[model samples]
Target chain A: MLKISGINASYGKIQVLKNVSLEVEEGSIVTILGANGAGKTTTMKSISGLLKPNSGKIEFLGEDVTGLRPDQLLRKGVALVPEGRQILAGMTVLENLEMGAYHRKDHDIASDLNKMMERFPILKEREKQLGGTLSGGQQQMLAIARAIMSKPKLLLLDEPSMGLAPLVVADIFKIIKEINESGTTVLLVEQNARQALKVSHSGYVLETGKIVAEGKSDELLNDSRIIEAYLGRKSS
Target chain B: MLIEQLINGLTLGSIYAIVALGFTLVFGVLGIINMAHGEIFMFGAFIGVMITSTLNAPLWVAFAGAIIITAIMGYMLERFALRPLRHKQGVSHLAPLISTIGVSILLENLSHHLFGAGNHPFRASFAEISFQIGSITVYLVQIVIFVISIVLMITLSFWLGKTKAGKALRATAENLETASLLGVDTKRTITMTVIIASAMGGIAGILVGMAFNSVTPQMGLSMGLKGLAIIILGGMGSVRGAMAGGLILGLAETFIVVYGDSGYRDAIAFLAIIIILLIRPQGLFGQKIST
Candidate 1:
């Protein structure tokens, strides 16, 4: 479980996140839906410790982790699959997967790795291939698979559905649902309102660094303002 | 005659390759040029001399000691000088370069003050032993340096490829922010990179010290410049390319000195770099990554 309260984050003098707050229960897929320049990515980054919050609290699994380093958060079983698939392009697919579990000292990594390859057969097929050479869809799958390697308690995904074909997007959303069903708590940030609400247990709508609405996924999906602004409907 | 020159070139090439490898590693990981790297190399030789003279340790122990000590110094420099500048915009890149130069000058002055600016002999007396092959005579020191360099290169390659820490390092090199998100301690990784690079520089210094029996503080600048040229010639941040570039530069220098004049060696090397950059600015094998 995670709780973010009254968090403010900035890039230099320009504040990006202002008084942002949200919560995610254990094993719940919490979706934060917002348009471009709405500080959705900033909120995720602040939680993952890539951007230190100026003022607020980020408690993950009952520990106050507001100012921790990214690695420290990771060691505590928190992981972030960043906005872009920032895979080490020069490294092989297997190497990228190995890098995902960098903090783990567990000896059963080989078995876990096998499990990952089993889940993504394409990765196994191209295990020796450089990450850069992979197709966009494969790279996205690799990014998610790589994140899964860490066996994270809480996974923060920022825009996983970005830059994918419609079919690929559906496949990725299905994977997200499967990942959530398998008991990993996920906080997904997306611009795809329909797809994100369909799978998320709960959802929040953010506008200009402020959470404008929060409710059950179905309720938020049916809300009139959400339909007009984010759901791409004509206003009555 | 060509065979003799080739053998001699290999010996010199091995040393430059090691130094260039160090440069590329540090530059690759942190995006800092480390102008003080050559000074660290000089310090390694000085450390070797001190260990051999005062502790009377074996040659291998002295060599290892030099590397370990200089590496620690590098770690300290990273913590004290580099980390503070990590978040600073625009001028942050120049800070490390300037700070490293400051450290270089500081070390040079200290060594000069303490060692009295004279050429110092390393305690590795085994360097005097030589072997003859056909018409070519090879000093035992040259052979030892060449063998150790090869061993070090193998060890470095293994460390980078086969180890978890090495993978983390490569990740850090590729994308520091992303690596951190994946659980790499960026602070620690950066420090480790500096240590590894400085250790290589130290080893190169010891090889140079042993081969020539002349250790002077001023030697760091020339060695550092040569390393810069080698890295540029190879392509910035390419380890294998550094090795190839170093060999090319070293052999070219050796051939120039042998057939022409020794004074023209540096000029010819720089000219080669200009020609290479003109032909392929990205470097012989360097990947054009935004550092």
Candidate 2:
């Protein structure tokens, strides 16, 4: 439902995303795997309207949405859970959730808030607690729940598992699968290649702002280069 | 005698408190200290006086007219003066700060032309009755100023804490980028913030004019400087800090004038700020400086 074609994004004169492009289907979880400084976040920023691309177009669900503001994209049912989980640290968990749906004029928001509280019980217990005071895992959960609170047709998650424990990472991936199964397409950016491939239907391997490889998740998992670059020692 | 001074100090302090909140609200959201905020206050007071003296209007009419006009001025200051500079690449924080200083000078001069830099009587023709409170007598005007300030404070707290529009404002203040991603129209939030904060300054202007029975284009000059001292003494970007700091400075000024000398009243705000910073550098209620 989302297509990015030859988008070039830059910070000043220095370009970060060089002719990068990717597609996210209507009901599939697409993962973009890359190491640090590989332009993964820049691509997401281009799509989500944080950074305007220097050239090319971004079509979301068939409308040309390039150059729109972040809030504008959100109003159109595209939500991004940015890197580092950028929670409003001084705000309460409930406020954070409410902010996730700031543009919605719908009356069902309270009911959706209740549904989120039910899904993430810790959120209910800590509803009034400041977001900065939450544990890393709990913060990640809040970030995801907050993004989904917008009821976006497409959710872009950037490194949700970064700095998380192994068990918590597994749980996050499980939650991603659950979210995808519930009908929201996810475009996930991660360095956790193994778990990402296992959870995704198809994936692209980005290297230094260029897409180096793209195929079925299982095929990319077995690709010798992907294994060497991302999978590391299979024996471990 | 003590009770009389305390109440008088409180009456004056509430005026300072409202002015300080005006400064703090802009600083909190935009992270830019609007030097022109003092002029907004001054302008509002002038408007109040003009309405009373020229229009022969009631107090409420002058009050509403001053707030609405100043609020528009606040919105224009953000939209026209600051937004363009804010978006420019490689623009340092100093750029916006310097521009506001320019706006301050311009507004002061404009007011000088409009009102001729002279004090005007405001509601002085109205008969004011003083009622006895124990050993102290309080003017009806003083009572009005204090009660209005308290009501304003309560309403402001409720709006900031409980309303969705207020939450959007706080969220933008906390994190601009994240707030945008969450569907907050940051441009609108920022504009509205300045409008509300400037209206606060307008409120202070009316009250001070009423208390002193006169208004001048130069009045905001000293009060503006006092606002800076109060925020520094209270804590930067804190509403409660502004209120508490204003009261302390007000009480200090009142006592100094009564017991020490009238000359020391103006210096009280700066002296208190310096002393407070020496003991607790973050002001009375500020968080530790973050990286």
Instruction: Evaluate candidate 1 and give its CAPRI docking class based on DockQ.
Output: medium
For candidate 1, report its TM-score. Answer: 0.96
Candidate with the greatest lDDT versus the true structure: 2
Clash pairs detected, candidate 1: none
TM-score of 2: 0.97
Candidate 2 residue lDDT tens string, B141-182: 888889999899888888888889988988888888999999
DockQ of 1: 0.60
* lDDT for B290 (candidate 1): 30
Candidate 1 per-residue lDDT, tens place, B128-234, comes to 68787888777787789889988988888898899988888888888899899888888888899998899999999988888778889999999999899888989
